[model samples]
Target: MIMRQAWLSSQVLSRVEPNGQAASVWRFFAGALFPIQLGSRGVRRIKNIAYGPEGRKHLLDIYLPKGPATAPMPVLLHVHGGGWIVGSKHQQAQPLIQYMASQGWLVIDINYRLAPWNRMPVMIQDVIRAVAWTKANITSYNGDPDFVALTGGSAGGHLVALAALASNVDGLRPELGDADCTVDACIPVYGLYDLLDQNQAMEVGVGEIRSFMTRFVMPKSYSEDAALWEKISPINHISPSAPPMLILHGQHDSLADLESAKAFAESLSRISKNKVTFVDLPGQQHAYDCAYSPPAPEHARAVHRFLESVRKDKQR
Candidate 1:
């Protein structure tokens, strides 16, 4: 009973607004139990550099290794997710990004325009533009432009997935003019695969989710633009040409249903010629990486292994 209660409390407390009584209560206890760490000995943080069409929101943080590398390091592009409305580069997966940096990998944590102001494809375009910027400029940071990997939770997962699969779609970033946005590998944690909800798998908070998407994120309703909805969904764009993907979804995720992840993995396995790995973690919840706990570090190590394995494959 204590375990169940703690688990429930952890999930509820994570969502509480900052500075509120509930959040204060949570921080008072959680602050000591699992202290957050965003830096390591060999990692260097370079903050708030504008990556593109230089608006306030069009920015990213680059984490580099302080130690000299024999050759250019691999790159990992992290996209933050907050239901398409909220979240930032600094708030999500700081430990994982720092760990990657410590391991001699260049990590780019990006911020994209949110909904209600920027609208749909703009968020997608912003991330793609970040990729273009990375490919062109990451060499200066001792990163190999050709070995780019993508990772994020929730909305970030969705964006990175589309960033890899749907890069060829129109209106993403016309200004780049052949700025290759193709990622070599992708790791989407607890991502929503089918935004159209064609299978009606999103039984939890269906109404609010649909209303928010149609009103803010989408230029038109699914009924009005079925083709467009189909195109943006990552699952629909699955092909043999897609980059290697490691899809991680929590089996007990309260936000993104596990069904979507299973379906996404099945689709990729069936169609994509590249490698596909899906891990259904038991007793885990959405955005668990927001804090650095047991499984968070474990998963981060797994991701590093996967990235290194991909690097080895390409080298051969």
Candidate 2:
């Protein structure tokens, strides 16, 4: 019962509004258990940087590593998942950004407009714009613009995967008129790849997918926009030029499911010559990395190993 209560409290804490209340909650949580929970070196150089137009869902936070800014570090651009309806980068992705910074990678966690307020292409645009912004200005944060990687979990993972899949799509190209927006690698954790399949699965309470469809795109039911669903689904777009990918899915995640990860890997391997690694995490669920109060040894080791392998491949 205590654990259940704590889980409910965590969800409530996530919904607490106002910047002050949010900060207070962050501080309270950070102080109580986080200090002793993880070994990551917390750096305060993180700051929110807006990339899109004025108003909502136009910002991102860049977490800079505490070290000399002389050499460019590999960049990780993360998107947070709230079923595409509700979420804040400050809450969902801050700790992960901090951890990446501690690992010597500059991290940028993006905030894109959710559904009802915005539509399908708009969120995609927001993500691509964030990529463009990072590619153009991340050097200031000691991040190598040329080596940018995209990552996220659940809905965020879908966006990351979509961004990676759309890297070569002429329509999805950013209007920044700057350097290329291509990412060097991808890490999508428990991301929904097939929107239609996910929507169908969510009918049985697989996740909040039914709501995501309503919030994120025009028309509540995915059936209304069959073509659009196909257009935006990451599983539909795979090519040989697609960036190398590392997909991690928990076996216990009924939300995103392990099949999606396997399907993505199979698609990449069969259709694209790019490297695709699938890590099947045992007995874990979606958003397992969001446990800011405790350490996730399995996730950490898997991610560390994948990053190392990708870095080595980059060196070659």
Reference-based TM-score of each model: 0.87, 0.79
Q: Using alpha carbons, what is the TM-score of model 2?
A: 0.79
For candidate 1, write residues 1-316 as lDDT tens digits.
4334334444443332222323234433443367576467788888888997757688899998896889998999999999888988889987689889888899999998998777778888888999999999999888899899999899999999999898868865547887798999999989888776665666566566668789888888979987777777888888999998888877678988788677788888888988898877657788866776535555666687778877888889
lDDT at position 62, candidate 1: 92
For model 1, which pairs clash? none
For candidate 2, write residues 200-307 as lDDT tens digits: 333344346556575555543566766666777888788888888888776677777677567667767787776787766545577867765422322443454566
Q: What lDDT is obtained when candidate 2 is compared to the true structure? A: 0.68
lDDT for 126 in candidate 2 is 79
TM-score of 1: 0.87
Please estimate how well model 1 matches the true structure, expressed as its whole-model Cα lDDT.
0.79
Best by lDDT: 1
